[model samples]
Target: MKKTKLLLISLLLTDFVMLLQPENAWAGDVQITCDLRVLELTSQQRNQIRLRRQQYKTRQRQMNENLMNQNVTDRQLSLRHFFSKSAFDNQQADEIAKQRYANDVRQTVAELNFYHDIFQLLDNRQREIWLQQCVQPAGRI
Candidate 1:
């Protein structure tokens, strides 16, 4: 009787542990998304927010692409490759690229700031939702 009771208790404990495990049936399809559900926003305001978010993402992509392209060009220019034209022009090309890269950085920071300002409008509850969404890991496309 004692052994049987121990076995039953162990089985129940194992079942409880299994039940506590989180479900991920949807796995990659699961998105912890948050929208402007808490706020009263007009259609135009919603559209504007959507547009700004899109533009902000575009700026991030641009920043990454710009840096990568600049790196490739700098490497080629250092080696005086044909794509880099002449060794004489390499220095000027590098400086111009640096200036343009700085401008892109500034623009991206400005856009980020604009989004931050928008976030400031949220009440505590809305802010909590927004922060939760922000902290979530980026999902696979």
Candidate 2:
């Protein structure tokens, strides 16, 4: 009986640890073929792309911070609702969903603009290289 109990406890601990592992841990064999450095950018083009990339990164960071804060606020509100007798606010939920959608749109536009700027900076040969090395293999239609 003691041996059976220990085995069961060990199984439970193993399951718990498996649950905490990231889903991407299973993707160790996946490889990326796109190499941005193959562009062989000139100094001026490199500087321009760097500036645009930095701006895009800053925007993304800001969006992530805003999203984290919003999630915290939502979690707190949910806890309060769970303890209270008040009904759930469907209208407020709708507003939050709208805001999230807007944020997604804004992020997508920023990403598109950043890529467009980088593409514009690339020469004809570089553009072809980017398309072949980065875009085509990624299954871009």
For candidate 2, give the lDDT. 0.71
> Per the 3 Å backbone cut-off, how many clashing residue pairs does candidate 2 have?
0
After superposition on all CA atoms, what RMSD does each candidate show versus the true structure? 16.4, 7.8
lDDT of candidate 1 over 69-108, digit per residue (tens): 6666665665565345644676666876676558545764
- For residues 21-139, what per-residue lDDT tens digits would candidate 2 score against the true structure? 54323232122245678999899998998899899899899988887766667767855665574777777677656765687667667766777788899999999997667654222
**What are the lDDT figures for the candidates, one per model?**
0.62, 0.71
As a TM-score, model 1 comes out at: 0.36
* Backbone clashes in model 2, listed as residue pairs: none
Instruction: Identify the candidate with maximal lDDT.
Output: 2
Give the top-scoring candidate (TM-score).
Answer: 2
TM-score of each: 0.36, 0.51
Candidate 2 local Cα displacement, residue 120, angstroms: 0.9
Pairs that collide in candidate 1 are none
